[model samples]
Target: MEPLRTVTVRALSGRVGTVGSGDGGVRMTQLNGKPVQLKEEADEPGWEVDPDDDWGIAVVETVGRQLKLRREAVGMRAADFGLAVGYGEDLVYKIESGKRIPRPEYLDKADKVLDAGGLLSAMKEDVKKVRYPKNVREIAKLEAQAVELGVYVGLSLHGLLQTPEHARALFEARQPPYSEEEVERLVAARMARKAVFDKSPVPALSFVQEEAALRRRIGGTMVRRRQLEHLLGVARLRNVTFQVMPTESGAHPGVDGKIELLKFADGTAVGRSDGAFNGRPTTEPKELRILELRYSTIRAEALTPGESLAFIEQLLGET
Candidate 1:
């Protein structure tokens, strides 16, 4: 039998850490200045906060722990693993140290080398879900889980339904132009988010669009036509309800900002405001009551379901 390779472990900050024996396998040496047993195959990637356990660690810390454990168990040194994965040893160190985000490719390579089943893939999704700007990622998460989404867009077509051409133009128009690759990635991400529409239990989506979103022609005539046609097709989904907040409405709470109210299976609501990171994932009764009141007011101030549909048709005719 192969002899087990042992490595020194040290407590850093408040978490366990292990240093390689310049090879594969790790053994704990100390934790929090005291000796503690570190199992080679035990699941200790992330911490759950009970009063008895530590809390206040970000999810990223857990991911770093998992990567470290997996890397050591496979008997590969950080430099060797980096070689196999096409990255520098320093990058591997940074990732294992929880100082940087691991790319999907790095995670895949680690998974293969460590025989990690699907843990790496799952971690990829978790990391992506966490790293993107909080507001956009949160909206993406709620969108995926939502059985019904009420979207009110003031400046442009709802992102999920945008074509690649339109999406690129929109993204590039940011203060700085997005690189070609960034634009492609952004478009792909948007398209993937739209898959919720195709789920077996399709989400009920009601889009209350502003007249300006249609009239502005964001990507010019061809892109605008495609966007309009896409909107009409999405509107046809039996589960989907489309509405337009007309200019003629004079004024409404919707005019205050963009609103995305998601209704989950448990009757909870999550929402994003117009600005970045301006949202709450609230399930508390008091917060829910407040969101309910505000949403109801906004809905009332906007057109009724029937009237909104007619407004969409009116804009469609103008096109």
Candidate 2:
């Protein structure tokens, strides 16, 4: 593949112009025998594209190529294009080189500035499909395939059981605060993982949540009320079980933190913990045994499935 040349493009009164590097003149190129202005400079930083992510890479590269072509077709400098699109020059260069993922609004502005006739903005849908961080997708995949899923949550509701409003509240409360678009995307992905509940041969699902998690009031009173009601409904599923460890249970094995186990019909399993294993998912049998033991003990100590439902109902009444 030929190396990408760095071209200084400037958007001038809605038209693109190229400034020559060596001489105080402009250089032009031809597209289908029609003369067009383009200039060459040093290459920008190269992005280390992930080889495992073919779809994501393809979408980004396509958008980048289209943006570059449109800018060049009209003779716009990257800096000038950035100015028109409400971004910095370096960001414009990164976005055009496929090193940065442009936000949807960025594409909208670029479409208008470059006079793309909606061509550039149309890429937003493709980009949105791959916008989620890769790790979340992997976890969602595991949840979708498991024959049995066990979870012990200490702080917040498990993603699989979160109501849309509750999940949105959690995402909105992140430290840096996700953009409105990002909050919507994350909530949608989280909700999609709930497909496990609707799968044929319905997976056996067990949840052990600390009492604190139930009473934390994640999304304030109204959201929390709906979330509790949602939990009561989920607990009624024949294949699902819910257990709540009372706050007075006092320093149990689960005090170490959250734990998760997923078992498949083929006897393959994976486990994760926020305690000893440092929170990374593991498939090793030894790690799986330890996680299973801890989870089993926590579930045994928690309130029985029927009692847990009553507890949630009581909490709902208090709301």
Tell me, by lDDT, which candidate is best. 2
Worst 10 residues of 1 by lDDT: 44-53
TM-score of each: 0.56, 0.62
lDDT of 2 by residue, 183-215 (tens): 765676676568788899999999999999899
| Model 1 Cα lDDT, one tens digit per residue, 150-256 | 77778888887687678777988987776654555566567657768877778788777777777777778787777777777777779887766667777665666
Model 1 CA lDDT for position 52: 17
Looking at model 1, residue 141 earns an lDDT score of 80
